[model samples]
Target: MNWQPAKKQNDYVQTRNKNFSPPTVNQVLQNAQKMIGPISESPRLDAQVLLAKIMKNSRTWLVAHPKSRLGAQEDVQYRRLVARRAHGEPLPYILGTWEFFGRRFQINPSVLIPRAETEHLVEEALGLLRNNRSVLKVLEVGTGSGCIAVSLLLEMRSLGVVATDISLQALRTAAQNIVNHAIGDRIDLVQTDLFSGIRGQFDLVCANLPYIPRKVLNNLQVGRWEPRLALDGGEDGFIYLRRFIAEVAKVLAPGGSVVLEIGEGQDEEVRSMIRLGFPRAPVRISKDLAGYNRVVVFET
Candidate 1:
């Protein structure tokens, strides 16, 4: 709630000279800071990082060489990037990469951006693996950027994974990420809604499904940028979630567990659904950093 908002860099540029180029990093940062002051509190920092990214230099260097000169071409490109940021484009999308679970993931507009809170799901999965030393089968539903699957493989060796998604585009992104992390051989990526074509029992299952209620999504800033299929849940926003519960019971092994990410206020309802669908399966919910119920756990 009190997080620092990154600043827009274009505000500093003189309006009369819309195309006026900043010839130095200091000039760029100063202009960015000026424009950013009214737009956001963290404009200076955001400007530095964006400029540094363009120059392939570290933030420290940007601060160290505030007076260092930038070439004509570099200034042109930096201004364009600054203009985009000024319009509220996400920095990660601009850079094309995001660090998740200690690894770098190529991120695009195709999937929901991986969040730090989801790391708890990964931690939960790791804890399960630790207890089940012989476990080798893992399944990840709605495997967005393949961050969850790739992170699991990086932690556990010789593990077999089945990552599924309903979006062909999302699957393609996940597939590329799986290969990028060199887990293609160990993990099989499939395009299916929930568990439509998934087979066999798995020792563990993980999902970060679309849980936002259709009504609420219309009111969120995330909806404006993220793909709707990756965010919209029909009506109460539990459509995919309900389907996941029914399908999970059929594919999960006895005594195995499934970890799911739930929307802010849907924890109790999701737990009820899981309980009704998997009467024998035990259910639990975990909170996110903000202490909101955010994950649903079911153990058979």
Candidate 2:
């Protein structure tokens, strides 16, 4: 797999620089931008955010107080984190928190970092279920950090969610997020591969399962940094998704829906599979901010 390549870590790590003194916010950001430019798409923003995180201040604060110097310990910590980022570690994993659907979620390498594209899946679910008068029951196939399930519960007051993940470590990570959002009572975190131990009908099913095809995953930095179990979707990237489609009819209530975040060009393939599972269910497609074919939906 192609891990994000960076200039050597030793170049960035001074490894904590015991003799190094604190530097002004602007100075440190300038240095970090050069250090992180290789692996990050947004070097300056990444530098600012990481430094702001270390400083316990906002990026705007950093801008306004560009001359403000970091403490000795904070400087060391900032460089240490910069080294980790320079080595291809994702920013969210380094920071331990990521914003999804306007809320911050705790994240680790154990779980897939929540992506903005998946918010379309969440919105698709809410758009279909929000007006329903009854309490909507939701089944999230791979809960990851529980961001999707948690986002749903927060937006709609009448949702009861049952979220499952194959990895116990991933589930533990999701559990922390569930607690962080104070939605534990409303959601059940289960450790199961797909729908293995799951039962009962649901009003809606939403998932951002691993759909990165093995070949594509092989060349992607995400596959290197994110959990393999949460990124690999077998040879064609449809292993888990196909399995979910096959079993969905058995668990979905009449008129219920399935919302999924699919790969950029997998819309037709996913639609074809959904056709086999729910021949008559109407399918809807929604694009992400980048206009990629992203969230796909089908209703039973």
The window of 10 residues in a row where model 1 has the poorest summed lDDT is 1-10
Candidate 2 has an lDDT of 0.87
Q: Please, what is the TM-score per model? A: 0.89, 0.92
Give lDDT tens digits, candidate 2, residues 173-266. Answer: 8899888888888999889878887889998988888988999999998888899999999999999889988988877888888899999899
lDDT tens string, model 1, 215-242?
8999986798788898998888989888
lDDT of 1: 0.81
In candidate 2, residue 150 scores what lDDT?
Answer: 93
Compared with the true structure, model 1 gives a TM-score of 0.89
